[model samples]
Target: MKLKKLVLTGAAGRLGSYLREPLSKLCDELVSTDINDVGNLYEGETFIKADLANFDDMMGVIEGAEMVVHMGAIVDEAPFEELLGPNFVGSYNVWEAAHKHGVRRVIYGSSIHAVGMYPKNEFINTEVAHRPDTFYGLAKCFTEDLGRMYWEKRGLESVHMRILSAAQVNNPRALGSWLSYDDLIQLVTRCIDTPVTGFAVIYGVSNNDRAPVDNAKAAFLGYRPKDNAEDFAADVLAEADVLDPHDPGHMCHGGPFASVELGNSGLAGMNVIDDRKKS
Candidate 1:
């Protein structure tokens, strides 16, 4: 089940850093790339500095790779003009280069913000129409369609992992949306090892009692998450703020993203911890 080469974009990022060690073991050579250098490397891993917005850079990084984990991007919401190169063009470059190089599949880090406008009470599935909360979410929607088109038109495979909350479970919303790091690794592993996923979409969420999204349609991928944010519910809820019933930030699936102004930072209000994995 090992690949000859696996490319991981955003290797210097928080989630990417956590993945480097595991992904390195999944392949003979793990080619990790990012705009900045990853300070250290794991066994069977090598780092390459590359910008996602540049097609030539992406092509060179992806060449000879069996699978690509496309995680590089300006993670927070920003002006469409500012995000145009990194988020929009970057995804296009990855898909196009993977297509040109005959790569097997792309496992993308899609987000819940892609359908952030949906009410938190209403459980949505992968097939729901896009209701992006920000330009960042819009970019996710765009890449998802891009992945679908690539699979249908060129026979390239893709797995769009609509990650909910891959952060610390510090708030009430996270009790339903959290995707723990261990679960994140498992989700990506399933995407890579699944035998024949032509074009699939899966919600990257843990087995929480209050999970807001359904992954039944993507059962073929065999991603069964283990952690539950409910473990942190007692402490988090004891110090929780009273809910504003009228606020979309509390009522919508996007959480803070659903209420943030366009081009504003959604992470700013989230109080997400800086927990990037160290080499």
Candidate 2:
């Protein structure tokens, strides 16, 4: 695996804070980007503040990097107007800039919401068609298609990760959705190191017993997550009454996001305890 330079967007968010250090090790230089200000930069990283919605800013943030881990975005169910700028336009800007900059790969931080309308019991695979549950999800779909187009027409490699949940499992549903921080790192690292990944849409879920997607297709990437949510099940299950098993949040792909309103709770509802950089 070539240790090429990496550019990481959303450097200040929950997942990015966890990913900042380990991901920094994968590259000769890691340009950590976010709209917010951060302190105590990592060893191999340089911080850059930029709006994802701005094409010029996005392009400038990604300049000179060989690959990008696009984790920047509004992370919840927002109104279409709210989503258009950061979620939709930002995604396009990132891909377009990556193409123009001669960058080789883009590892997208796609959400499970991209296929959120699918039934919960269906045990979806990578082969399933997108059934987005929210406007936020629709944007993810757009990027996946953009990735396919870029790969088909321009030879740009894209690895779209349908991240289920990149934090601690807080409820009964998350047993299936949970993706530990270490696992998230492992998944992204695999996406980065794997040679010749021509526009693949893989799940960023864990090795949980109740995992919905069959990620065997992307198994060659060598992302074998070591963590499991079963340990939290005994306790969390005791608190959460088993749902109707028919409601979309309980029985469909979006989980809580299926019922959430525009700009309502999503990751904001998770019991994610995000810690900052260690001094």
Top TM-score model = 1
For model 2, residues 115-218, the per-residue Cα lDDT tens digits are: 99888878788878989888888889999999999999999999999998776677877898888888998999999888889989988888898888787877
Overall lDDT per candidate, in order of appearance: 0.94, 0.86
Per-residue alpha-carbon lDDT of candidate 1 for residues 64-179, written as tens digits (9 for 90 to 100):
99999999999999999999999999999999999999999999999999999999989899999999999999999999999999999999999999999999999999999999
Stretches > 4 Å off in candidate 1? none
On the 0 to 100 scale, the lDDT of residue 113 in model 1 is 95
Candidate 1 achieves a global lDDT of 0.94
- How large an RMSD does model 1 have? 0.6
